[model samples]
Target: MSVPAWLARGVFRVQEAAMRRPTFAMLAELERTQWLSRSEMLDYQTGHLNVLLQLALAHSPWHADRLQAAGLADAVRAGAVLPSDLPRLPTMDKRDARDNVERLVWRGVPGGVFPYTTGGSSGEPLIFYFGRARQAADAAGRLRARRWWGVNPGEREVYLWGAPVELNKTDRIKSLRDRLVNQLLLNAFEMSPVRMDDYLQAIRTWNPRAIYGYASSLALLAAHAEARGIRPRLDALRVVSSTGEPLFPHQRELIERVFGVPVSVEYGARDAGLMALQAPDGSLLQMSETHLVEVLDAAGNPAEEGEAVITSLVSAAQPFIRYRTGDVVRRSGRADPGGRGLAVLDAVVGRQTDFIVAADGRIMHALAVIYVLRAIPGVGQFKLIQHAVDRLEVQVVPDARWNDAAREAILHGLRARLGATLVVDLNLLDTIAPEASGKHRYVVSHVPLHGALAQAVA
Candidate 1:
């Protein structure tokens, strides 16, 4: 027996309503408006900080004890403190926060409802919760950023991402709805030259106003197209936004030069909403209105600019108070004295876990591999796995036109960077799979952490 059409519609409506609650709508609208003015932005940050403090005091047993231990319970009770005062509070790790998520909500209110599990790409997975307000803020923040790149909710968007949607799952319904709402989803796992040629044809036919996808996937497509001499007139595309991985200067230039559009780079994680975006002028601007970001040193004092620790000002359900993000960053400058009071993040190195240590004690960022290999034509998805201190495995999914020259160029580049003593292995495959959380890790390292690599500034 088949289910009734009305029942299916009813179920979809319920899910959509749950995803777009009034509280979320209000928070999203507030976030949107806050970015318009410097004063308004400061007020939003202050308000979020106040909300977080209340949540922290009520739900976070760890934070509450730390506050009391520091003898600042009264100061917190008095009123909202400045950013400078925030560092004096105790630091909370992911495990500590995850273990006490239930206690972090407002008293008597069941802490915002939805529970999420973090992907263990950085070693261990974390389970946490977020109130409806925070969930809505995230969804809305994503929508807002899409708008900045000229993508609307109902427009057709070609997604060049790593994760493939299961057609047989319940998510298939949502995928269908997404298409009905005018979204075109593409699989990043299929990056062969033939597949990319089909994708280029689809772009010409669909004429999508915007392209949103992973940087590595898009870069591969551009490189493949360039080699094949198949230049599709993508003039209909207004913006191409790349996320999930860092976009190097060379990669950005290649995409822009081939596709004939601006490539907007964004930085974010599953735990937080949008963290930063490339401004029209090409500067990386942190989303200060909704998040409080800090770069800190080993002493726990602010670093001039190093590893980024973030506090979610807008999340009351799961208060990420000074949560370490495990990504290295450079601070642009101090918060504007007479401006929005939002901190500036200059750049983000890949995951802290992926920094490869060479035999000569030189630290190599993941981008070094990405920059060297992505320039080669017919190379699709790729991953660099470090097996030993000086041994590395480079995996690639090549297109039909791939050759030994491309492989040689990659090995030569690695040899130049890591010295002739470094042993490099090239592994070719049909495809490189993305992680469960729908993100691709370009670099993987088994090296254990020894010293702190992040520095922060006040």
Candidate 2:
């Protein structure tokens, strides 16, 4: 049964209050702060950053030492730390976060810290602690972003996402909770032809206001619907929000064509919290009110395009100060074209798996190798699989331009990025297969940050 929008909204607000999350309150604040001028936004970020720093100094011993060593401890104490001074402290990666978690967490923080785990999509699972504030920020941020597309809280939303194990008590409870909040969940993990047909039917009946799911998963469903000539009747749908992976151009076009709605890209990680969302004007706007994002080159200097390091202001329970996110992105110097004060990002290139590691330990984005093959006229469609640090497998579906020269160019280009000592196995095929999980990745690296997390989180 469908819940009334107003009643569902009231239930959700009450639930958040019962859990002491302050979610709706934060949402109200975000709606206002998003319009602050650039200079004013910086001041807001600085103030929040200092408060998070103060919490770290008083509780998280690991972060306290780093702050003192960076020579910003006194300034932080004096509440004078600027966003620019953040570079003095070294960046922390997944390994540092995993190993030093005990000292980094403030278990006694207000509202209490709760244990959480990353999805381990990068093959590196991290167990960390987060407080209620982080929870509120993520929830409120998503609600605010959806509002940009005319999706209000409690409006019916369909989630094409992973679900808990089926036929369990927890699954039953989750299903009931989802309906109470006016959401319908379709399993992205189980997407056989028969299952997809049922999902399409269910979506037609639900008639949600918005849809959200992984970029690849959404594209797969959209392609299936298009191929079967079975478009769901979605008169109320305002937008289709894509997350998890980078939404390529072809995927966006296919999804928009099938769904008859604009595709909005949501950029975030489980550990990084909600970072940015694509606005209606086609610009990716940052969650500048709660995050301090810095784009830095390989040498750790600021650049227009490089790795993304973020500081989550609301993460006082376990401050992610100067946390290195392995994903590469380009910085947009332009302000939000939609008249918002939030900073913009040009693109989210890819994550760690999207980059290949050479035999000599050099890491470079997959585009380094892709540029080589794309320049070859013979290659039609291709997939690069890095089996090991020194070994790679290239699967190519050739076109009329296929030739010995094209083959040689593919080898030369791969070797250029992955060192000449690297071994390349090139295969010509009719088609490249999708992953078992139904997602498509141009580059798949088996060994990313090799042996980074040797043990499970205890």
Model 1, poorest ten-residue lDDT window? Answer: 449-458
- Clashes (backbone N, CA, C under 3 Å), per candidate, total 11, 1
lDDT of 2 by residue, 217-249 (tens): 677677778768877779999999998778888
- Every candidate's lDDT: 0.64, 0.81
Q: Residue 35 of model 1: what lDDT?
A: 48
Question: Per-residue lDDT for 329 in model 2?
Answer: 90
* lDDT (Cα, tens digit) per residue for candidate 1, span 385-414: 888867888888776558988888888978
Where in model 2 is the C-alpha error above 4 Å? 119-121, 163-172, 352-458
What does the lDDT read for residue 95 in candidate 2?
66
Q: Estimate the overall C-alpha local distance difference test score of candidate 1.
A: 0.64
Number of the top lDDT candidate: 2
Our tally of clashes for model 1 stands at: 11
